[model samples]
Target: MIRTLTEKEIEISGEKKIYGTLARPASAYTDEKFPAVLMISGSGPLDRNGNGPKGKYQLNVYKELAEYITKLGFITFRYDKRGTGKSEGDWISTGMWDLVDDAELAFKFLQNHPQVDRDKIIVAGHSEGTIIGTALSERQELNGLMLLSGGVGNLHEFTTYQRMLTYQELKNSKGIKGLLMRLLINEEKAETKTQKQTKKIIESNKDVYKILFFFKQPAKWIREHFAYNPRVGLKKVTYPVIAIHGDKDGLVDPSLLEELSSLVKGPSETHIIKDMEHGFRFQYEQKSMVNVKKMLKVLPSRPLNPDSLGVIESWLTKYFKADVSSDIKENA
Candidate 1:
C-alpha cells in the first residue's frame, strides 16, 4: 500500500532563517530515521515550490518530484534560497556562490534532522541547481547526486548557445524586430557603438527590450554565473551521479549528458528523456515559437514526465537502501 506522507514547515538558521519543508511517510515512527533527499530548485527567482514569477510558466517541477520521492519512502527537504520565497535577502545582490552557501546550509540542516539518516543524504538538483548540488557533493559525503537538465559546458558557452538558439527561433518565426535587436545587442562591436545601439533600442522599445533581454536578471548574479564552470564542480564530485536531460530541451543541449557522465569519478549514468522539454514535461511536438507559447500557457496544467521520475526512482532505489523496517536500511 502507498503510505501517506506528512510535511512540516521548518527553518534552517543561517545568514538568514531559511524556510523549508520536510516530508516523510506518515507512518514513520518517532524513533525511525529515513533516507533523505534534498531537492534544489533551478535558477532565477524560483521559490521552494519551484515556481518563478517570471513569464506565465507555473511548472512546480521540484515540488512534484519531492512529492513523488516521498511516496517511495524517502524523507525530502526543499527550501527557498536566501533571496527567494520566504527566505531573507536581496535577490539582486545574490550571486552563484551565495546561493551555493545557502544550499550547503540546507544540506547540513537536513543532515541534522531527527528523522533523517545523515549518511543516506542524496542531493538532487534541477537546471542551475545541478551546479549547486555538484559543489555540495564535493564538500560533503553524499550518498548520491542527481542532475536534471544541467549543462555540460561552461556557463559562458551555454549562455552563448542559448542566445544563438533564441536568435534562430526568432528568425524562423519571422520575428525581424527581435532578431535585429538580438544581433545589435550581442554583436562584438565597439563598446561605444554597442552602448549607443543599446541605449537607442531601450529608448525606442523600452518594454520589449526589457522583457526580452533584461527581465528579472541581476547583473552580479549573471556575471558570476557566466564565470563559473559547472564541470569543475562535477569533476570534484566523487559520489555516484546520474545526469538526466530532456531530448527537446532548448535551453541546454542534451549532448552535454555524455560530457557530464564522463567527468564523474564514481559510478555515473545518463539518460535522455524523449519528448520531454526543459521543464521535464512531455512535449511530442518539435520546437516552434507558437508551440513554445502554447506550452507556456498550459504549464499550470502540465504533468511531470513519468519516465524521468521512473529513472530517478530506480536509480535511488538501486544506489541507496531505504530503511524499510527499522525506519531505514542501507541498500546492500
Candidate 2:
C-alpha cells in the first residue's frame, strides 16, 4: 500500500517557499534503517509529482519510480522546485546554485528522519535536476547519486543545438523560412539572444533584427548559466554515481551527458537508452504538451526495457549493502 506522508516546506536560497512529499514505505518501519533517495525534478516550475505548466505525461514520473524503488526496498523523498506548484518563488529569476541548495533541503530533512539510515542517502536527479544534484554530490555526505537525462555540454554548445532544432520547427511551417534563416544564421548579432528569446519571435511582433541585435550584448540569464558548468563541478564528487540518457533527447545534447560520463573519472556508470528522449519517452515528439507528458511519464530504468533501470537500481542496492565502488566504469 502506498502510504501518504506528512508534507513539508522550506525557504530556498532566494526565499522561495518550496514544498515536498515523503513516500514512506511500509517496510521502512521494520527493516534495517533504509537507504533514502531525494528525488529532484528537472527545470521549470515542476511539482513533486512531475506536473508543471511546461509540458504532457502527468503521471508523476518521479513518484512512480519511488513506488517501484521503495518496493525494491528503498525509501524516497521528492519535492517541487522553487516558484512552481505549491511552492512560492520566481522561476525565471533563479540560478543553478539556488536549485542545488533547494534540493539538498529534502536530503537534510530525510537525514533527520528516524526511519532513514544516517549513512545512506541517495540523490536521484532527472534532467536539469541531474545537473544540480551531480554538482552537489561533491559537497554533501551522500551515499550515491543517480543522474538521468542530464545536460552536460557547455551552455554555448547546448544552446546552439537547441536553437537549430527550434529554428528547424519554424522553418517547417513558415513560408519565409529562407529569410528567417538568413536573419539567424549569417548574422553575428543573433549570437547573443538566449534560445527562449529567439523562440518568442514566433509569437511576438518584434523584428528579426531586434532579436538578433539583443544577442550582440548577451543576457544576464545566459551569463548565469555559462559560468555554471555541471560536468566541471561534478568532477569533484567522490560518491558512487549512476547516470543514463535517452538516445532521442530533443532538448539537451546527447553528447553532453556522454561527455560527463567521460569526464567524471571516478565512480560513475553511464547508460544510453536506444530509443528514449530527454523525458525518457521511447519515441518523443518535442512540443510544449509533449514535453509535459514526457516529464510526467515514469523513466523505467531503461525505456521500453524495464528489466534494466540501467545500473541505477543495482548501484543503490549494492551501495546500501556497503560495497560502494570508488572506481568508475562506463557501460554500454
Candidate 3:
C-alpha cells in the first residue's frame, strides 16, 4: 500500500536565513522516525525546484528526486542556495566554501529533526553538489553518499573541456564569425594576452565578452571551484558511496565514475546510464545548433530519463537499505 507523504516549508539559519522543503512519510498517531536524504543542486542560479533563470530552462530535477525518494520511505530535504530562489543571500559573491558551509548547516538541521533517524542520513548531490557532498562525507559520519553526474577530476581541466565543447558547438553553428572569435580568445593562449589586448578585442562585442569573462569565467566562485578536486576529498570518505554518470553527459566526462569509485575506501559502486544526459534527461543531440535551440525551447515539456530514478532507487535499496515497499503519500 502507498502511504501518504507530507512536505513542509522549513527554514535553516546559517550566515543568512536559508529556506527549504522538508518531506516525510505521514503516519496517523505515531512519533516514528525514518531515514533521511539531503538533496543539493548542481551549479548556477538554480531555484529549489532546479529551475534555472527564467529564459534558460526549467528542469524541476531536484524536486522530482526529492518526491521520488520520499515515496521510498525516506524523509528528504532540498533547499535553495544562498542568493537563489527563496533563500536569502547574494548568489554571485558566494564562493565554494560558502556553499559547503550551507550544506553542512542543512545536514545538521536534518540530523536534529525529531522525525529523522539521525544515524541513517544520506547526502545526495548532483553535478557541483557532488563535490560538496563528498567533502561533507569526509568531515561527518553518514550512512551513505550519492553522486549524480559529478566530476572527479581537476576543476580547471573540466572547465576547459566544457569551454572548448561550447566553443566548438558555436563554431559549428555560427560559421566563420564563431570560429574567428574562438580563435582570438583561445583559452590555451589566454595567459599570453595582456589585459589591454584582451579588453580591446572583447570590446568589439561587449555583451558576449562580459558573459564569457567577468560573469562566467573569471568570477570569484569560478576561481575557487576551479581549485577544488573531488578526488582529493573522495579519498578520505570511509562510507558507502554510489556514483552515477550518464554515458552521454556533455558537461562531465563519464570516466569520472571510474576515478571516483576507485578513490572510495569503503564499498563503492558506479553506474553509467546509457543515452542519459547531464540533467538525467533523454539524450539530445548537442552537436547540432538547431537541435540545441529546439531542445532548450521545449525543455519544460521534456520527460526525465526513466532509468535514472530506478537506478537510484535500486542502489539505495541494496546499499542503504532504504525501504521501497511502502506506499505512503504526503502533501506539501
Model 1 local distance difference test score: 0.75
Sort by TM-score, top down from the best = 1, 3, 2
User: Across residues 1-332, which tens digit of lDDT does each residue of candidate 1 receive?
Assistant: 13568899988887777898888876635878888999888877788888865533567777888898887889999998777778998766677777888888988988888888887899988888887787777677888888888755655565555756765666455467666755655434544554564444434422123435555435456556666777887777677888888877777766677786678788999998988887888877775433566777675576878999899888988888675663332221
Per model, state how many residue pairs clash.
4, 8, 11
What is the Cα-based lDDT of residue 316 in candidate 1?
85
What tens-digit string does per-residue lDDT give for candidate 2 at 1-332? 22333233433333566777776545323334666888888766678887766654354667666666665556677777777777776665566677777776667778887768878888888877776776677557777778877656545566577666655555454458656755656323445554455445334432222444544322333454556777776776676777777666666666665665566655777787766656554544444222434444544333443533545566766677522111111110
Q: For candidate 3, what is the total of clashing residue pairs?
A: 11
Q: Which has the higher TM-score value, candidate number 1 or candidate number 2?
A: 1
Assess each prediction's global lDDT (C-alpha) against the native.
0.75, 0.62, 0.74
- For each candidate in turn, the TM-score is 0.83, 0.71, 0.83
lDDT (C-alpha) at residue 197 in model 1: 48
TM-score of model 3 vs. true structure: 0.83
Q: TM-score for model 2?
A: 0.71
lDDT of 2: 0.62
